[model samples]
Target: MTTVQPTVVSAEAVDVATRGGAGTARRRPRGSRPFRSPQAQELWGWTFVAVPMLLFLTFVIIPVVMAVVLSFTDYAVIGDPEWVGVENYRRILDDPIFWLALRNTVIYTVMFVPLGVLVALGTALLLNRSSRVVNLFRTLFYIPVVASTVATATIWYWLLNPQSGLFNIVLGWFGIDGPAWLYDSKWAMTAIVLMSVWSGFGTNMLIYLGGLQGIPRELYEAVRIDGANAWQSLRHITLPGLSRTTFLISTLLIIGAFQVFDQAYLLTKGGPGNSTLTVVYYIYNQGFGGLKMGYASALSFVLFLIIAVFSILNFRLTSRRQS
Candidate 1:
């Protein structure tokens, strides 16, 4: 009688406890639910995420939709947006300045991508050792990367200044005359590429540094045991170990180079016969400056398409190389 009564009491206790938790909750046959009301729990779950979800829909979703709709129209931010079908897109094909901007962008990307990767890789290789001095140098290198685009451009503007600038002064010390960087059309883009590489390589350097950590130390020891020199070890192991990192940095560099805007706008202003008029800068000029928002939107999409194609190509090439 006592055993049976204990079992009955225990069962009743568990039932009571389950029902008491989470007000208005139902008792389950087997498992105890943490909350009483499923709907109430669901409501609170949604409440927590409601703000971010609303923001995403409002800003990202709505703007993308508006841009797509506007791309098909001739809205100058004035009267009602006039629907022009594919005329805006068709006009882009015949626009001479569009081609020029694209050519300049391509040139910038070609120069910037390889140089950016090499600088980042070289710096990472140089600084990957475990030492306080290495850490300090790494921090110093990364400082420029975190600086705002405007700030970096302003500093470079002064550094690359003609006649009185630091670059010309240094060149003069070597009995070499530095070309007018900011004013010379032929050299302006080159100067921009150099500045970009210096300013941006630090980020990829960090990425490469992290990738270095993932490489096994025994690999280096194995190479050393085989009488491998520094150059051989680097060529065979270090570069191979960083293939994935290189691919990622290369992809990012391509995207960023294509979107080159702030530097050109702040330092060069697409001057010297529009030598630095990048695709994004051209889009900005047409969209906001000239109030041809619709055409600019179309240009923006074209740029998006170009970036997408290049990104896909990069992925395929890397994958093929790996395979």
Candidate 2:
């Protein structure tokens, strides 16, 4: 065999061959860089959210737990809480005022939700047309939404005045006698419903406007090509399009209707003989006015359950329509 020549490796060849090799990687400087791991990232996340979590635990979780515990006892804020079993609940069953309040709230919700949805939808439809004037009117409608609830209630108090309010004056022009709204038990709840609708419809109008805008123009065009009338298009396209929005608005209105207090408190003080006393007003009276915190907590849970039931029912009903 011929003698094998020993290969001469040049400096450039050695440098190119050794570049990014394991030995060079080992020799590279780390420069004070810390190694990161999933556990470290997770720890950092928890650290960042620690304060907010603590506050949530302290304020929301703790209070809800305490309310549940307190509902089974009589803690009138004057002495040690004594266990009362379901006696408070039984009292609620027998309490005429509770039933009356529930009825009034139910009636208010029944009257308010449909009217609110219709008025909001109508106004939104009217405002949805492309024009500067429509935009201006949209802003005007939403102005009441930003106004303070207390201030709006005060304004309604003046507006609902039987003798001198603009409402009766308008009725007077029609040659009809307007009844005493706040002073009459029969009209007190109705008056609250009207005021509630007026002050709050602006928010629902915006929601409806958003829903209306989301409807694809193709659907309307298709319906139009099919020779569908305005009512048919509304029934098949517009209403169906706004079904979910209606559900959301209805749920909110129901919850709010059951919890109505500020307007009733300011307008009639739950009077005309307790016609406007809602469940929330009842809870307020017990919790603060009468110092019956435990009973109030029980009432609160009951009201919560009622709202929950209604909200669930509304969701189911609206889901069917949407489907």
TM-scores of all models? Answer: 0.86, 0.88
Cα RMSD for candidates in order? 7.7, 11.2
Per-prediction tally of clashes: 1, 0
Candidate 2, residues 230-283, lDDT tens digits: the string is 999999999999988899899999888889898889888889899999889999
The ten-residue window of minimal lDDT in model 1 covers 23-32
Ten-residue stretch with the least lDDT total in model 2 = 1-10
- Candidate 2 global lDDT: 0.89
Off by over 4 Å in 2: 1-36
Best by lDDT: 1
Off by over 4 Å in 1: 1-41
After TM-score superposition, what is the CA distance of residue 285 in candidate 2 from its true location, in Å?
0.5
Return model 2's CA RMSD, one decimal.
11.2
lDDT string for model 1 (227-294, tens) is 99999998888878878987899899888889999889988999779999999999999998999999
